[model samples]
Target: MLEEKFERLRNFLLAYFNQDMESPEGALQEYIEENSEGAISTTLAQINTFLHEDLTEQVKEQFIEDNCDLYFPALELTPVEWLKQVQAELKSTLG
Candidate 1:
């Protein structure tokens, strides 16, 4: 199921980029707009599960620090909070 989800996302992105040659930032924005619910849900589920499992603390911290701005603009929120926000946004988008 996860593989299928990623395949769908990959196809969407390829088609998106093919239609309009956009900058990396523009592609990201378009990706979110085009696949908002799937993107958010898949990312949230993967990150949430990864965080919950036993992993290198350093790596996890580095990832959160690197992606916090991209995924969660609000710097004040914790990582878990960010995941919850993503999930909420996905639900709202799908609804």
Candidate 2:
């Protein structure tokens, strides 16, 4: 299911951030390998589109509320704002 895959990808990316946000291509590669069911480029494109276009603001807010503990203390952004940054990073990595 796309919904489950998206959540799994989100969780993986967030956990990856908890470790290192400076580099995400590695995480993206790992996720691709984990779900090696289709073309890697297609998977990446789908995820990029989902992060950049599909999710609604309300959904993003709820995601933040659900994962408050994942916040980085050094960043003053609210959870939703931080999530936007993460989304940008993931999109960049996809490219």
Candidate 3:
């Protein structure tokens, strides 16, 4: 269950980074409400760990390379920068 949630979070971030989301904040809020089990802190902590610790630099770079053709043309961010941006957005949105 945790792994599935983590995968969903990863996919959410991937879609966000790829600019495939029309309303990221709303979508994320819904997702949290649905999956957080009334513990937003635990959910956020798990997601933060996934974003900040589980996803290594090499994995991120490889993901970027593999999805190079799919990213938004105007997005000029490296993998680390993208992760940071996602983290910041998540924090701001949740708070």
Candidate 4:
């Protein structure tokens, strides 16, 4: 499930975000580990929570500040395009 998502995610990050794989992944993992004090809205809380300590004030503030047009990725392709890739690969196997 996740490997299929990497190209989409990487393209999104590269196009609009200041982050690369490690920085964004670290941020997300930190979000996952950090325990919240308040009743976190589910929408906000689902990003990540893997922090091991109280996050610094600045770091906590920037955790999920992902800047991307993730709703419509620039590298986005239609399902038909993906299917065509599969078809091309299968043609090699059948050769």
- Candidate lDDT (C-alpha), each: 0.50, 0.53, 0.52, 0.33
Write model 3 residue lDDT over 1-95, tens digit each, in one string. Answer: 43454664555555443445455345455655565443545545655665555666776556544432334334576655654554675566557
Count of backbone clashes for each model? 0, 0, 0, 8
lDDT of 2 by residue, 1-95 (tens): 44465665455545654455444445545655565444444545544565566667777556545533454455666655765655555455546
Scored against the true structure, residue 21 in model 3 reaches a CA lDDT of: 45
Candidate 1 versus the native: TM-score? 0.40
lDDT of 1 by residue, 1-95 (tens): 33343353334334543435444346545656866575656755664565565656665555444432333343465644544554465456557
RMSD vs true structure, all candidates: 7.4, 5.7, 5.4, 17.5
lDDT-based ranking: 2, 3, 1, 4
Worst 10 residues of 2 by lDDT: 64-73
Clashes of 2: 0
TM-score of each: 0.40, 0.40, 0.47, 0.22
Better of 1 and 2 by lDDT: 2
Q: Give lDDT tens digits, candidate 4, residues 1-95.
A: 22232333333334433434344334434433452323123312222221222556344223313333222233253322322332343333334
Give residue 10's lDDT in candidate 4 (0 to 100). 34
Off by over 4 Å in 4: 1-75
Task: Tell me the lDDT of model 3 at 1.
Answer: 40
The full ranking of all candidates by TM-score, starting with the best, is: 3, 1, 2, 4
**TM-score for candidate 2, residues paired by index:** 0.40
